[model samples]
Target: MATLSAGGQQDAACMHIRELTMNACKVAHSAAGAVAEGIATGVNALLETVRPREIELDRLDREIDSAVTTHITGATEESAREMLACMKLSIGMERIGDLLLGFSNRALVAASRCEMEDVRDLTLMASRLEKMLSEVREAFEMRNLDKALAVLRSDAEIDRLRNLVFVRHLENPGGTHRSESFHVVFMTQALERAGDHVKNMAEEVCHLVSGQSVRHLLRSIDKPLEQMFLDQLRTKHAL
Candidate 1:
């Protein structure tokens, strides 16, 4: 059997990284789904299922780390940038998985004590996160900057939901004892922070494909989004 050339090896390594990152995204998405259901339905058994998936995400993160370290030493600049993007994405997904697991644990303990409003907001956050992860997978797979931008835009809603929860729990006017307020707040934070990591992954996807940060693209371009993306692609190809 003939040994693969260096370029062939690098290509294989990058593909492996992409595959592992996609798998991690799926795992995180599944975790989010489980948390959403567990919170919405008050099912402890539903929440119990995320722990092993969290372990799978960690394993994928380590695998991505090793793949990048091994192949990035002698790679071309473009390939190296993509490999780094893969590493960033995998790390973000793993953190998101951990956050979802934490959220699930909190739900197990506090879902009973939470008010209807609290459960509604928490479920909404998890459901939104699940959708975001789905978009992250699609955006990364297709290198779709538009989808990535959409993910970035959706993060604000998560932030808003988190703030709503905080205001309700932190300042009750009647001097009432809010049972499991700490757990509710912690769960809110975990979902919000997971949204943040998802945003970072979307930014990395934009950067990986377009050679520009999401902030730069959104701030510097005055044209419509589709036009700006088209112009950028033209500029890249013309170089």
Candidate 2:
């Protein structure tokens, strides 16, 4: 093998970091998919899909920590930025994995008790979370800012699903409460928190590839859909 130059070595290190980060992301995305599948199918499917993967996510997290520690020592400025982004991405993915596992645990107990509407809302939340993770991965791989923005926009739907679930469970006008309402609310919150982490990843991707925050990028955008999202976000935050 030829001796590699310092820059070549850094490039190789950055690639390793990116790959590790992507692996963690995939596991997180898988966890979200498991939640949807579990809620849709049954507990057996959830156990098969979710139980063993937490260990895998933990292993990936450790490997990413090692990669960042080993690679950042002599990295050039650009490479260091890339490594930091990888580090941030891995952190978010790990948290998402944990949240999804918790969601699965709640789902395992909640499945038999859940009504059709409960199942419907929770499954939709999981599906949206999975989509957000998918788009974030695509954005990272392609350095596509639009995909990242799409992930950001998709989060609004997840939040809306969450609010709908809460209103049905907590504020039911009929004054009827289901026994599984607690579990349903917890599961919704778990998926919503996971979406928040995914949103963070999307924002990180925006900053990583463009050197600007998502808000700054939105400010310069002229697209109607994106502008609508920004306005709604502003209105929501104002409330």
Candidate 3:
């Protein structure tokens, strides 16, 4: 009788342990799903901000800021830490957008008094930078490392264009008025810094996905890594 009672107790304890484990797994899965949903929502909101639509950029910034805060505070898992890092990167990218908008506003204000030729080069540079900005944002949304790396490479092009425009303005002070020259310099610096932020975000993406810091890797290496990711996607598709 004692043996029977002991065996019964053991079975009950095993069942309890199994139930506990299953419950824990369910909770973990629920938390992971929530985190993924939050990230997707945040990315979508950011894309809307980048759209050429008349939406207020400040509103998008506030939305992203709130999302980052919630993502960091709402979860207590290691994965949440990675998510927080990505959110921080997103914040930086969004700030770039804000800066770009400021430049646009300032350019519009200065248009009344500024010579078109004086600001023409700067305007062209701004247009190219804006395209790069869009590409970086798209890379993040799609998690395309290749596109992100391409955006990084394009930064050098932007820097070159900025330098060229600055040099032209310096060579002929009469070509660009003093105040306009200063404003151009300021806006160009902001755009260059925005490119840097986009590159930084690309590095964060690599770290988040692979647990590896490839920030030091050359742009050359990033190409192969991107190809590897593409190959993996292809394999998954085949399966």
* TM-scores for every predicted model: 0.90, 0.91, 0.56
Task: Quickly count the clashes in candidate 1.
Answer: 0
Off by over 4 Å in 1: 173-177, 223-239
**Pick by lDDT: 1 or 3, better one:** 1
Top candidate on TM-score is: 2
Query: Which of the predicted structures, 1 or 2, would earn the higher lDDT when compared with the native?
Result: 1
Error of 2 at 59 (Å): 1.3
| lDDT, residue 18, candidate 1 | 80
The whole-model lDDT of each prediction reads 0.88, 0.86, 0.51
Q: State the lDDT at 38 in candidate 1.
A: 88
Q: What is candidate 2's CA lDDT for residue 48?
A: 60
- Which residue segments of model 2 deviate by more than 4 Å? 222-226, 230-239
lDDT per residue for candidate 3 within 108-192, as digits (tens), equals 4453455555455455555555555556555545667667666666666667767776775667645744556666666566656
**Best lDDT goes to which candidate?**
1
TM-score: model 2 vs. ground truth: 0.91
Q: How far off is residue 133 in model 1, in Å?
A: 0.7
Q: How close is candidate 3 to the true structure, as a TM-score?
A: 0.56
- What's the candidate order when arranged by decreasing lDDT? 1, 2, 3
